[model samples]
Target: MRYISTRGKAPALGFEDVLLTGLATDGGLYVPESLPHFSLEEIRSWRGLSYSELAFKVMYPFVEDAVPADDFRSMLDDTYQVFAHDAVAPLVQLDTNEWVMELFRGPTLAFKDFALQLLGRLLDYVLEKRNQHVVIMGATSGDTGSAAIEGCRKCKHVDIFILHPHERVSEVQRRQMTTVTGDNIHNIAIRGNFDDCQRMVKASFGDQSFLGGKTQLAAVNSINWARIMAQIVYYFHASLALGGPDRSMAFSVPTGNFGDIFAGYLARQMGLPISQLVIATNRNDILHRFLSGNRYEQHQLEHTISPSMDIMVSSNFERLLFDLLGRNGDEVRSLLEEAQSGPVSIEDYRWKHMRKLFDSAAIDDDTTCAMIREIFEHNEYLLDPHTAIGVKAARLCRRDKAVPMITLGTAHPAKFPDAVARSGVVSQPSLPKHLSDLFEREERFTVLDHDLKTVQQFMAEHWKHA
Candidate 1:
């Protein structure tokens, strides 16, 4: 599939080039020239396949140019080998019709691993094939850092550097990233919010000199379309298991960067009979404002119990807006600038169109805690802060009688032990094996100012001879 920039100026690129070159040179996100479709018959035909087999089917259209069939199948097989469950993403029914999709069964204990693990294998295959090196620069609110670090650490021909806001992430989140001692992995604790870390990464990418220098840079974030593609497979898997287009389903996603819900949107585009993509957010709810038509504004970050959703700007929103504007690049550009500069609103028709496909809601810290407590008390379901937000959102939206609502459980409860402990439910078997020893390790990280120049200098100095 040919990928075109959301902005008009850059030349269109193939899947491999778009995967390697993250953000477009023209300052746009890459989107497929045409969205692929799947018929109900075709979707039903995928029943009873293994996870890897289904993954290759769902992702083949988006990645066929970059990954050949044999190699892609091999990579998918290796990627899921370490998963705790045969079904990497499992569905659990919390109530009569409400379900929670548990997506934290991987090495890092978060949904980010759903994509990043395969990303690591894909990067390894591509680099080995071309005999090239790449330095992956990523900015994470919490889970993405550790998941990316875990995915890329100690791999040949790649150096991974992840920057996260210091004091903004939880202790567990910080330790998860910093405790790794791989020579090829570097972690930076930036003295600001996630927006600062994201800004620095973007600024570094925009640096022509840096791009022309020794290290070749790529992103493992959802900005790389491959990440979103990898995520889309699970939605198909979950929907098929639940009876798919023949039976409609709804999803409540605890969103921060908007990647997960965007995958749901992709599934809808692919002809799944999805009823609603409910977007669940914490205190920082720019997306809620947009969906409600109150105002779409970017503000200074606010720390929340769900630290991973503590984002002011939602990057993946651009891809959705691009589609909403009828692929009119000029309108998409104008809308983004307006939304960033101040509060802006798309026309009512546009919002109404979006509302038909999505429902948005927010839960504060107090409600998040209450939901966690209530779920455990009533249903014996233990949820972290992120999943608590999703559960609450799904409950709120269900008043409209949305059926088969599935809240995407973004991380394992043990990843946020404090929240789970506060919820008054202990694990039945206790934390998983990889996370069982987190309390025993010493956390280490280099603190840095929120300056792009400082980050560049650190990269240069630490990796000078690398």
Candidate 2:
């Protein structure tokens, strides 16, 4: 279960090391050297297992060598106990063969809670054993900041800092991160876009001397292999619930950072019998452009109603390119380096191979609002802006009618009230009881300029050790 950097320069690491050391020194994401494939019988035997039990079975192989079996099982149990839904990740049918996987039942009301909840526990366990403390810095467009802060707030061994673009995130999204009062949890609203905040996090990962070199840096973002590993379980869970490995399933994922759909790609690689993987994007559609047109180019990041998907640069796309290029790290490095100046095109053969398994559609904000209204009128299902893009893409880009298509419901609609309002729906969605007082709570966060050095200094001054 060793992890290798996509750029071929960093040393191979075990699960724990990869969990802590995100964004390899060579500026590549880490991926498992080899994936564990499940036999058809193995996949069938998982039917009727509890969500926690199923997660343990799917993820144990990756961490079995690194974590004691009992401890890992206990952590999985504790991590999922907080989800609001009994099924953890439940499936609700929208049409004959169309379904939505509800992933927002977690504490933060977003799909990120599925991974961040587990990551926080894992970090605490590992750090406690080694008697070490690390700084956890992450960038979120909206949901990840709240989910990451909620997950890691109680961890004594870490100081968690999250940065989101000021005035870019929704009111619910911003308050969810800022309202939580914990000495270890710090939120920063940067005067830039999500990509700018993300760039700062990556830059800090590359050089941690700003932390005085005594404390190591950790990541709660999808760059951490643990986040991706935890996400792979839900794909298996959803498929098995709806007849999987025996029958093919298709997934439509609304993704910005590219980590969530990359998890689906990994599931198919692990013998899950997936027929198609659809990339659903908002106005910022770099991934859509790449898969549909072979044009991997960056454009100005657009602020859409779906703020979480308002990202021009997709970081996890590199991991997929690393595989599509036959695991040739040097070629991946060369392609990405070339991408800095302008668009980079893949060879026709590689592009065709990718098209065989992947399809994409870019939905605009108007289409997203219309789909929300349409779904409500037809099925009485309320979809958030992000998930609406996924449903629309699944309908437009689906290659087959018989296969069961599942769109990943990425967030609760209440998180983006403005988008929900634009749909002309009479009843506005309300926050769940746990977060009902989100607006009333006093928020504590620092508004910082987009300068990297100033941001770094702020972190240094307020860090737990300092």
Best by TM-score: 2
lDDT of 2 at 216: 85
lDDT tens digits, residues 1-466, model 2? Answer: 8999999999999998988899899999999999999888998999999999999988999998789999999999999999998999999999999999999999999999999999999999999998999999999999999999998998889998899999999999999999999888889999999999999999999988898987988998888999999999999999999988799999999999999999999998888999999999998999988988899999989889999999987889989999999999999999999998999999999999999999999999999999999999998889999999999999999989899999999999999999999998745699999998888999999999999999999999998788
Encode model 1's per-residue lDDT on 10-104: one tens digit a residue.
88999878878888887788989988899999999999888889998888888888778998999899888878998888999888888899999
RMSDs, each prediction?
1.7, 0.8
Q: Please, what is the TM-score per model?
A: 0.96, 0.99
State, as a TM-score between 0 and 1, how close model 2 is to the true structure: 0.99
Clashes of each: 0, 0
Q: In terms of TM-score, how similar is model 1 to the real structure?
A: 0.96
Best by lDDT: 2
